[model samples]
Target: MSDSSTVLKYTPAEMMIVVAARALAGVRTVFVGVGLPNIACNVARYTVAPDLELIYESGVYGAQPARQPLSIGDPTLVTGAISVTSMADLFGLYLQGGLVETALLGGAQIDRYGNLNTTVIGNYDNPKVRLPGSGGACEIAINAQRVFIIMHLKKRAFVEQLDFLTTPGHFHGGTSAQELGIASKGPQLMITDKALFDFENAEREMQLISLYPGVTLDDVVVEIGWQVRVAETLSETAPPTTDEIALVRGRLSSGKQSGGTGEA
Candidate 1:
């Protein structure tokens, strides 16, 4: 347990994970993706939501992975899972069935409305960098009750318009997500390295509500492509407690926790 006076050493990645983990506190079932989302959900299971059930897109439900999984096909996701069904069932039964409470997603680019682009960097016909097309992310974005996006914030990443729209967030703004048939309350929160945002306004735009202890408003504004919207009363997010850092390191070992600070 960490005392109030203690200052634990942690990386920005670890801090982001801790804050992202905290956001899933009361959720019962989560459709977790790979990478940082996986790590954050694992930490949440131990700390806040002890009964949290993690559903993987690879058809593993209620997964209790023995260790960190490298990808969706990692065998560890199946070893201790409640059930391993077909990918069709995982999507049709749990995800689209309206059973999942939260879904975590990330992409190469995100717009002001939270639409994600994981497809390509430039024109689809003649691409600059061809990205892996969306696998189950588009479905997760559409079906989950609440979607949480996790990615490091950078000017190039948080763009005014995506190079290509791979997954819909809020679309044009109010009622657009509903009009587009996205069932989820799309991207309720976006946890970045410098600040935290919540889509609580009518437009469903990313609104800065909290900043990391040492970061400033300009620090976030300068890194985002669109004009940043500020919450009326901005709050500062506290550094991770000793206990949170320990949990994050437990699952994210081997320098994974100490990796890059930015989206790139």
Candidate 2:
């Protein structure tokens, strides 16, 4: 039995974190990018996926950080890690070697095809806002067995086409990833604050699979830049249960809030 009378008082950012964490329920090993992805991985570890191994790009593997690390290079990640290897080994042996089961990533821009752009906001030559260029995200996006992208549902962020393709999704749509010889399956899900999406369609376009509580199709449509497709069996995403909320809040209570860079 679960507590049914628990009050639902949470922010959209918190909801995103809880939802993203839930997506990692049974994942064994996750190559975690910084920001929201990092928080989600730790939340999942404290709640549903206790044995979840976290691998950081800075070469920390199976990291059980006492507190949320500021970045991948933050020494706290290496505190209780299983093995602190070199960047070359981590990428060559684990990520590209196909040992990583999943990778959680965030992007500045995402298209209907799930292609991500974290390079720049505007023109590459004369950029509007230069973002943190893809640091291991390109490799993780193409090499991880499965990739989960987390971002907020905003009109600007969810564009029809990216200003730049920093990380490949279903490149130009279709079997292009396969044709390009990408060994790992890409862009499994795109978790957002308002809705949950999956690239289950034959075209590999992002399809709205579930909507968060109180959010409607119109709301999602208004936020996305393109004419987003809806799932045939569209469903409402389950609200966070009492236990799930507690675990997430507890894990994030160490003065580290959930919101991160560029909606991800």
Best by TM-score: 1
Off by over 4 Å in 1: 1-5, 251-264
Q: Count steric clashes of candidate 2.
A: 0
RMSD of 1: 4.8
TM-score of 2: 0.92
Q: What is the lDDT of residue 138 in candidate 1?
A: 95
Predicted model with the maximum lDDT: 1
**219: Cα error in model 2, Å:** 0.9
Per-residue CA lDDT of model 1 for 7-40, tens digit only, reads 5888888889989999999788998877788888
lDDT of 2: 0.84
Residue 201 of model 2 has an lDDT of 81
Q: What C-alpha lDDT do the candidate models reach, one value each? A: 0.85, 0.84
lDDT, candidate 2, at 16? 88
| TM-score per candidate, chains pooled | 0.93, 0.92
Each candidate's number of clashing pairs is 0, 0
lDDT of 1: 0.85
